[model samples]
Target: MAVIDLSKLPFPDNDLEKFLDSVCETHELDFAAYAGMNPVTQTVHGFVNYPQEWQTHYVNQNYVNRDPTLLLAKRSIAPVDWQRLRQEPSFDMVFSDAHDFGISDQGLTIPVRGPFGDIGLFSVTRKCSAHDWALLKAKILGDLQQAAVHLHDHVIQSEALSSVLGPPALSAREIEILQWTAAGKSQQDTADILSISHRTIEVHLRSAREKLGALTTAQAIGRAISRGLIYPA
Candidate 1:
């Protein structure tokens, strides 16, 4: 495994670009990025070192809705290797276009979750033989996950979530419930895990939604993640 010095990370919370640059240089990666979105509002934000042409192509093509990485990211909490993603045949053009712009199929995406329903995907990509890619991924996967978490946390602390709602204020129980639910646990499943009754769980979730200014439990989860109040388990 590569030796990572966490103390040397960028300080004052605004040097995220420097941090990503350092990682790409140190790891000899082709591209590295940290991207976040507010699921409730579908607002997207990204810190990326990808080729500008690729970015423009993605935007102009309106690929966000069709991007397979995003589709998996929305539902997944675990880190995803690009090779393992299941994409529809129609999305082949997206990958083909990316490759044409020098973006590789060999990549990894780490999903980041926050309290008010803010989700982030930190990704690193490189072009290499399959064997080399696997070896590199195995060696750096842990470090990448750590970096993603740190980057997400820094972004959350530095940025203002919304102009009107501000940061959400959720209770401990509410956060706990939301976290479990974000992990795909049903209300009954969460209630059983927490040793609480189903009705009680529902009550807390309802209150959480109101506190977060969300209209439903799912929206509440999204809002909570956006506020960094509850991370997906």
Candidate 2:
């Protein structure tokens, strides 16, 4: 389905819930969710259709810190298959508790990176034979990747910070400078190419990083590309 359909929904929360429901029905899965954590505030937001009891228990127990799936989200940008995660003794409790709560042992999590240093995970869970799930994941992986991107975009737009403080927009020159940097140009090189002084290049690059809320030039470049604010040369 086109992600634009989400915009037609009456409310952001309603849109996400309906999307999760559609995913469950379309894939014959037991549950679906889109979850994210704020990097600075350490707050979690969930658009999930799981049992309220399970959700409550998870938070009450601070399961997010120990959840193997969410822990993997920190280091991976690819889709994760629950079966493929390392089966360590320490992580066993997470999976065991999930199964007891009716969450399937077989699931997929698509890690999504947003421009503003936020990460989102789009997950689908189902109880199925290992063979059946492998085939299902093969079929839906590509579609879910695209869906994850759109879902994260919608979430970012609906965030309270976006409605209030908003993300800073880089100027054209700032974007151009970062694009050149991403293309492997040094500050001096980009300055020469753009007929500007090295100090001016440094200023623009710093401004771009600050605007993007990035700690480094490389991070600023990455943020710009992720947000479609700039393209690689």
Candidate 3:
């Protein structure tokens, strides 16, 4: 069976172009982009509607060091409204600089945790009425925010895992169950939280253990965490 295509909204195509177009159309936002920071490389990766020259200018000038969005994004554990960040002292320069690039006063950002300790961001950019942007932001709150970070982070994770760990055999649900198990949840507890049967929970765990080359669920959970297949609950 195919993985449930809950990846993004049921859009017309999987292409990022179509995906972002749908985002703009559906959300009534001006633009969307994913920004990734590689601390190791000291580089910022961004996908946006702006010109390449703009991106290059930011990069060449080493604006990452002073970018308000990047700074706010670094500390945020979840999506943040742009206005919430304008108060931070050093970001004033960034606020002034954003106008040069046409970043709107109103925006939303989804912070993503990438593989190998990288921090990534996905933002909806726009120059619009604050009230309209607020409404749009409210429409996508909780759901779209999680989806954005989840999809973006998972893309990077899948690529990194594909190269370093071959491929994971378990599905997302299986990974979820295994993660809960690692956190000391019982089969019954897992089933309750997952809304599945205890037997089903056991089945998922057993399958995960087999794929992870562990003789027991405990070993499987430990191995999964060590391998970055799971994280702290």
**Could you estimate the TM-score for every candidate?**
0.61, 0.63, 0.58
Candidate 1 per-residue lDDT, tens place, 1-233, comes to 12122334445634677788888887778889777776655656667778778877877787776777766765788888877774665348678888798788778889978776778789898999988888988888877876776676555544554434454467889889999999999999999999999999988987787666454688878878877888866
Candidate 3, superposed: residue stretches over 4 Å from native = 1-14, 39-43, 158-162, 166-233
For candidate 2, lDDT tens digit of each residue in 1-233? 01122333357234677777887887778997777766755666667788888877877777776777777755787888877675755457877787788777778789988777888888888888989888988888876776676667666666667546576678889988988898999888899999999999988887687666564788788889999998976
How many Å off is the CA of 51 in candidate 3?
3.4
Q: Candidate 2, which segments miss by more than 4 Å at Cα?
A: 1-14, 163-233
Model 1 spans > 4 angstroms off: 1-13, 162-233
Candidate 2 to native Cα RMSD, angstroms? 10.8
Q: Alpha carbon lDDT of residue 117, candidate 3?
A: 72
Question: Which model scores highest in lDDT?
Answer: 2
Q: Give me candidate 1's TM-score against the actual structure.
A: 0.61
Best to worst by TM-score, what's the order? 2, 1, 3
